[model samples]
Target: MKDEKLLAILRLQKSKAIGDILAKKLIVNVGDVEQIFKEKSAILQNINGIGNHGLKHLFDEKNLKAAEQELNYIKNNNIKYSYFLEDDYPINLQNCIDSPILMFKDGNINFKNDKIISIVGTRNMSSYGRDFCTKIIEDLVQYNPIIVSGFAYGVDICAHKVAIKNNLQTIAVLAHGFEQIYPKVHKKYINQVNENGGFLTEFWSEEQPLRENFLKRNRIVAGISKATIIIESAEKGGSLVTADIANSYNRDVFAVPGRTTDIYSKGCNNLIKNNRATLLTSSEDIVKMLNWDIKESPKKAIQKQLFVDLNENEQKIYDLLSEKGQQLLDVISLECNIPIYQLSSILLQMEMKGITKPLPGKLFELM
Candidate 1:
């Protein structure tokens, strides 16, 4: 089918409530989306919440044309759309009551992966919040899970960066469209994600990042994952929205507790206190909650022999890298006070021994 025609239909379908109603309507109608375009005003008026006023908004020629422009833009930019009927569409999202009608996808995704976790939190995060996020994400990578999050600032970005650094697939669910990225500072990072992973959204490329869209987006983030983790949030932040939605969907919700007096942590603590979320002190808690089997430790003799073979500098680096999965070369050098040239050779030697691997930006991690 011509891409424009397909998108036009999707753009029209976007106006409908995105659940069984729309799914049934599309199934019963079973034709080009443009044909139903004419019936939208009358049809929407009959649906609850979409009164004559809202119906009129649907029929606006300017809006329809703008939506067409968006479709064209998406096609131009090489973005692809996946509808609920598509085989590759996310099954978890499809199971939701208010799943998106169409999603704009920009990278590789194995939607069928058994392990998926949504990490969400406030856009404004504390230092402790960042550290907590880093530690948990590093641990989660061991299971090769897909990490989901909104591409917002603070905790969201931290999770994404960590996922990428650890060679995990991360999906950013945007509140806006593929046409533009909100919080443009993330544009560079988003590009990097697209190159390595991807971004997803229900809105068309031209759709604005309206305040209400974010609330709707939160549902997707919550719905698509097996569990949702809130690292930090203000009492009224949007992370709570994702947690509530996760609860409604019967997905596990985890919150990390912090000092009661800390503003950013109040939301997490409250959720835990109310029994709305499980209190997670470490990644081990989440792994256990999910019933994932932890890998057994290597035999003591094997570990001892492996340690004995390492030279003094190599042993020091190995110890540091084992404690944390990844560390920048500069950080390692500074901590060990080793010359860069010597450190490079040691890192290469360790890599040859299958003890570590290089990551983006000169970082290295234990294998």
Candidate 2:
């Protein structure tokens, strides 16, 4: 990319009022990101969602100076980045409406492997959570997935370490910038992590990890993968926030159930009870839910499963999916005369019965 283009992106990103969604709107409407800086403020304000508050920050001279400084830091440090409009941006993240318009990357990170999943949970993890985290990554090693996490304590670091042990790539998403690593104690693992996969962040070189930054970075952890797994979480934690973001993005979410009385288990159990996440027992659950083995199974397998017992609604959904090949969730609801609220449960039942499976973007078809 041209230096001027990069500078414009940095300037737009520096605008506190204009977030990713509105920034994308301005870029699309104006036909060029760089041109947004050149266009008259009155003309830019004419675009929908471009209010005075945002325009004030967009054209602020202080923001221009900050962008220039950050651009220099990026150049001096040889930092790598991805523009939302660029082809190199992660496809999964690109689909998220609120994903960062600009993101920084480092080390040996590669997007060639499409199998990516984010594992996150509480920092105060129990032995049970640790063992389960290790076992799942070991089992999934054969698939060579790129494990993603926040690189914090407990489940995040556990997932990263296990992935490296299995020789699988691992990505650590940072809430701060590359200039500093949080929890200075974990600094020892920095070299190993970089040699294994690398780091990613949307923050500038000197940004610190503030309380809200962790919440903000959760979306990237959720959006950059096929699914987000909560190994263990308390009643309230950042991992739960990541799970919510993943669900909002229409991606799969899985939670490991623990004993009801266990403090860390409350969140996972609630997610399962509320139907916000799938109850994960082992690696097979992840593989099956994400349809990782779909290619190995024969298409004829669908025909054999036709004899499986299904409820009236499940049968209706099965027949529709069987005939239509693959249909959107809304279309299935209409054709089967099932309300979306009711259809979601019916389809999940079919999935568990091995008669159907979900595809990305809420599409479904027979297994």
Candidate 3:
């Protein structure tokens, strides 16, 4: 919690081309980060790759001032930075060779959970891709797993939003720092996540969202999860990079299969064909792979009995909606063989009791 120690770590991380290697070196040899400044020349020379150019900047007054400014910004904004040695740091990521030495975070972080899963995929997703991601997320939320994603445009955004909608904790590991979200449009949702879950980043506040950072960020996403699920991806996509990293880390990688003709499905199909990833049809696939228990027999039976207690008419409506997902009032009346006027009142009562939810275009679905 020492401000000076935190500031020194931030300055080292901010330096380009000097990453965790130098950070670890400073921690091990210098006794403390402040000592790095005093013995700057000798320390730089001892490191293999670091040259005089890098060493010169380390002692520059301007660089120290910049680090102070960055530290001041974090303190003023109430941002939290967790170093690798900190208790709150994610243990899953601590062992990785290139793991981030520091992480800037905002909101609750639950590293103790065994159910953390990373849902990643292509930015360009089809409607099927959207539905698949949303359904699996909703199902997984029931178990209260921590959802992790990049918070990008297509699949990433869908997974985060659905987790939030279900009141589940969702974390976004950003390519940039917490000073600014990458896609400003997602700023609102990112704030919502901060209020509920949190955002994590390796870069300091002043670091821009560079392309290489994302590739580095992907490893953390993969390494921290029990499994990595790819909803959809092209043959060459960021999700595939994550899947490869997950495999290398000896974690399970699951891919949802898409049609062979689909450009997005090609990646998934290829993964399954080559045995690079297991084919995931539903949340059960992931749960089973992780050896999570399905609800016990007694609890499942109780739920079944509760489900059976619905009145005949309610059961009929539930069955119709469950099969078709959503239907307009007219469609429901026809499908359930009920009079339109009577069905209207019944649907209203069901909606009021949370038996179903209304959607746009005058559609309703079983809850």
Query: Please, what are the lDDT tens digits per residue for candidate 1 over residues 45-103?
Result: 54445566555555667666677777667667877778754556676665565576577
lDDT of each: 0.77, 0.88, 0.79
Candidate No. with top TM-score: 2
Which 10-residue span in candidate 3 carries the lowest summed lDDT? Answer: 296-305
Off by over 4 Å in 3: 47-54, 294-367
List runs of model 1 lying over 4 Å from the truth: 1-5, 14-60, 294-367
* Candidate numbers, best lDDT first, in rank order: 2, 3, 1
Task: Look at candidate 3 and tell me the lDDT of residue 204.
Answer: 75
Error of 1 at 177 (Å): 1.9
User: Which residue pairs of candidate 3 clash?
Assistant: none
Q: What is the C-alpha lDDT profile of model 2 across 172-264, one tens digit per residue?
A: 999999999997888998888889999999999999999899999999999999999999999999999999999998889999999999999
For residues 1-367, what per-residue lDDT tens digits would candidate 3 score against the true structure?
8898888887776665566756655555455666676674865587566677677666667777888998898889988888875557675565454578788888887777768899999999899999998899887776789999999999899998888889888889999877678888888786788766888988778677899989998998997787899999998988999999998866799999988989999999998989999999998888788877655453221232546557777778887776445555544554455755677788887777678787754567776
Window of ten residues with lowest summed lDDT in model 1: 23-32
